[model samples]
Target chain A: MHIVDGALSNEVVIAGSVLAAGGIALGLRKLDIEKIPAAGMLSATFFVASLIHVPIGPSSVHLILNGLAGLMLGWAAFPALFVGLLLQAVFFGFGGLTVLGVNTLNIALPAVLVFYICRQGVAARSAITSAVWGGIGGTLSIVLTTLLVGASLALSGDEFIPAAKLVFVTHIPVMIIEGLLTGFAVYLARKVKPELFAELTVSAEATS
Target chain B: MGHIVTSGPQVLVNAQVSGGNRLLDKLDPRTRIITACVYAVLIVSFKSLVVLSCGLALSLAAMQVTNTPVKATLRRMLAMDGFILFTLALLPFTMPGTPIFSLFGYGFSIEGLMKAIDIALKANAIILMLMVLVGTLEPVTIGHALHRLRTPQVLVHLLMFTVRYISVLHQEYLRLRAAMKVRSFQLSNSLHTYKSVGYLVGMMLVRSLDRSERILAAMKCRGFTGTIPLLDTMQFTKRDKVFALMVLFFALLLIVMEWMIDTTY
Candidate 1:
């Protein structure tokens, strides 16, 4: 889901930077300074988590877990996930620098969307119910992220329309993998540490 | 697709880049950050193949000067190319221009092909330059450098905290995986595999959250209010000034050459 530099038109790049800045600010404002430790550790944890490769068939796909991060952190996923992207770009050269904002927007916006759409469901009384909701949220986040990525590319030029379409189509399997993994992760969190979901809700509610 | 088992070292291995270039390392990190930003922006906006080729050559030259392993650096870049190759390949078919070739019923155009190459050159060059400049720094210095560059204080701190704990938490993650491996856990395409991996991640999140509480308590014990004090004191010395000026001169030369070529063409 990372868009490298020199791919986007100037207008798309500028728009992405502006919108991402706004999202980061909103996320930061929601996160109190005292919560920094938790946010940081969670952010690092997600970075580490993304390294885990779940085998789909002969190949493997690394976890994005943006939806899970959103469920855990609400709006704050924007900044935390942005940090993850930044590290990937710098250390791994997985994404480029100038397109940082666009990549951040593409990955994090759907995360915020997931939080809103599945927050209530993830808070369901039964672990199985919450897991189902988590699966839905996870699937939806990947679906929405693919769309945003396509839109950004397509908006840049008519030439990229096919590539944008391909981006979504190729990621379909990934969507299922992430959804299942997120579902089980949510189930475990629900069974062992229900408070994980509670913290996000309380914070989200208080902020709202 | 690197190994997940040794992710702590995987993330930090590039920090060894700092000692590779004495001249580059001597410059203030702020200079490198600013220079990379400006260079990337300039490279992205460039249209002429001549200009982009020069940018690529220049970045390649920087790599040579730094004693950076040419094979390893270019291999990472090749991986990036793999990511964008499909998109670039589509361009020749998608954009309308003079027909260069035909595949099935579709016509590939010269203009679209040129655009693809242009983008590829720009993308690769900027990434290479970024790796040589900003990517060579220790990750922690990047946080401090951004702070010095007036990045939002809270955001900088967030980056700092993330940088500080990525390795530690990665070690914790490895320990959990080791425990799983001890139980003869096999990663495969199955519900068992998915559930086990998910549980591993969940366990990681739960323990890290608990650890965070202890950290917050420890910070409060040490009278930490909101901000962690900046311990790094970076100075922009004469060498940094000289390097910034050299970068500026290089940018101006590229701009002048591009302008001249654009006008003539």
Candidate 2:
């Protein structure tokens, strides 16, 4: 998911940067003054929450929750997740600057897609139904993210195709865990704060 | 891959390393940020092993100059390499070239091996240089430098707010995890585990949302505007100029080495 500096071709990197900038701009447009606190809080929360180590088998995996993030932040997921990746790269040395845009796009695009597909379902009348939808969205985003990461690699070179396939295969278990956790999280949010999925105050309405 | 927190626990907090009054710590944060970016791209573009090794050496020198901790940096770099090794190991098998060896009757190509080594070198050089140069700056200072570099205002604001609140939210997370532990909660691969962790995260998000609302009200009450004005006293002095020139010369030297090696090839 976090492609390091030289792994990606220049074409992929440049295209990713252009598209990610557009997504961030569009997200910023939808974000008004009032929504800053909510967006920023979620950004910081996910940054911290990513440290959670969920045990799987002999090993454990941390949470991506990009689907949950997309469900929570919609288009703003672009900037929020981008900011998270930036911090991780700069502070933690996880991803490097050259690949930041490609990494951001691979992780965040799936998030925006989830927001579009599951926003209404997560706001369903019954908490159970909403959780189910959230679970599906969560799983789907992970799937999409892996696909994008695979695509980025596969498109780079023929030799990378096997590595791309390996990445997706190893993460099937992760996709399930993400789905279950996101579903339950959405259930809790629905039960406790039903307004969690309410539409953000787009700039037009906030000004009016 | 997306779920891996390869850096382990130390990087989540205490991001600021104690640089002992080093030159990197004193140079304008912008200089470091720009140089890191340029050097990263330059290193990535290089195909010569000679240039790559020199680039790595330069980065190591930078690390020494800045006095970055060896153990901490090694741990983080190794974490990244863990995943990378898995990916790059396959290259020798998938790529076709002169057969050097066989594993499971599959030919391992020398060309692919060289490519893998080249990538590993390039990735490590860029990351080491980046961590030593830009990662030393305070997160807030990085945000302000981005603002000064004419990044979009709203994005800068978002970064500032997020950086400001990471510590606060991290503490809240610790408290919730402690409360869960007090209740004898343990993690296992089961539905109950996912459900509880989900609840933990869900509750944290809900509370943080509520907290943000109160925070907004507090700020509004203080006549705070929507945007935080960039208020920093970062000055680019003669020292920064000297450092920036050295960086330029080093970059040019890398390009020259790359070209000189290419002709010999």
Candidate 3:
């Protein structure tokens, strides 16, 4: 889901940069002293999560887990993912610098959205119900991300419309995989560490 | 798509032209980062094939000047070309334009082909430039450069800590995964597999939080403040200015040449 440099038009790129700047500002404003270490650790976790490849068919796909990150981190997911993407860009050249703003928006905006939509259910007491909400949130985040990716491309030119649609189509399997993975993740968190969700909720309420 | 069991070392490998001309390396990382950004914006914005080609040439020339490995650069470009190739394959069929040719009752347009090539060239130009500028710099140097550039202090710190702990957390994750595997954990299409992987991620988070608490305590014990002072102070000297000016001149030349070509043609 990483949009490489030079893929977007200058106008779209600039627009994305502006929106991303706003998101970063809001994210930073919400990040208090106590949340700083958690932010770093979550960023590191997100970074390392990419190395955890899940086999699908003959190939494997690295976990994005943006949805889960959102559910856990809320607005802070912006900076957490930005750091991960920045390192990935610098270290592996997975994405380029010019497209950094757009890429960050594409990945993290959906995260914040999912956070708003599913954080409550994730914090709910019933483990199975929370897991289902987590699954939906995970799938929805990927779907939304793919749409944003497509919209970014499609908005650039009519020629990219096909490719933009293809981005969504290709990610269907990823959506399913991530959904299931996230569902189980929420289930486990609910079982073993209910306090994790509680901490996130408390921080979210404090910031809001 | 082979199994990447050792991703830690894999991420550690850089696209540098090993032990090359020290000229590019000597330039301040800030200079390199700025130049790379300029190169990307210039190439991405240019519309003409002539200008785009010139940008590509300039990027390639920079790579040669910096002694960046051609094989490694090509490999990275090829890796990203998957999506570019997909678009290239689809454009002619989907783009609305006069037919350049017809194959199996489908129209292939010359305009679409040119657009695809233009996009490809622009992407390659940026990738090569990044390979020359960023891939060569040390991660810490880049982080310091970002800090010097006055990026948000929080972001800079987050990036630094993430870079420092990636390998440690990665090792922890591997050990945990290995532990699970030793217990006959095989990832399959079953709900059981998903639940187990979810547990794995959950456990990792728990451990990461615990570790962060310990780390915070240790830092506080050392009289840590909100902002840790950077150790290496950077100064932009004559050499840095000279390199920056050279980059500026090259960029202006490309822009003028493109404008001239556009006006003349």
Residue A75 shift from truth in candidate 1, angstroms: 1.3
Which docking class does model 3 fall in? medium
Write model 1 residue lDDT over B1-265, tens digit each, in one string.
3542433224352233345467787788898888889999999989899999999999999989877657667777887888788889989999999987799978999999998999889888998888778777888899999998888778888898888787788788778989989999999889899889888888888888889899999999999989878778799999988888888899999999899999998
Model 2 DockQ vs. reference: 0.62
- The 10-residue segment of model 2 chain B with minimum total lDDT is B1-10
Judge candidate 2 against the unseen true structure and give its global Cα lDDT, from 0 to 1. Answer: 0.84
* Residue ranges of candidate 3 with Cα displaced over 4 Å: B1-21
Which one wins on TM-score? 1
Q: Give per-residue lDDT, candidate 1, residue B106.
A: 84
**lDDT (10s digit) by residue, model 3, range B72-180:** 6666667667746876788887778999888898799888888888878887788778877887776667778888899888877777777667767878888898998
Error of 1 at A165 (Å): 1.0
lDDT of 2 by residue, A1-208 (tens): 6788888888988998899999998888767777788888899888887878899899888889999998888888899999999988877778778888888899999999998798778878788999999999999999999999999998888899999999999899999999999999989987898766654323322432
- Weakest ten-residue segment in model 1 chain A by summed lDDT: A86-95
Rank by DockQ, highest first.
1, 2, 3
Q: After TM-score superposition, what is the CA distance of residue B172 in candidate 1 from its true location, in Å?
A: 2.1
**CA deviation > 4 Å runs, candidate 1:** B3-20
TM-score, per-candidate, Cα-based:
0.96, 0.95, 0.93
Residue B188 error, candidate 2, Å: 1.0
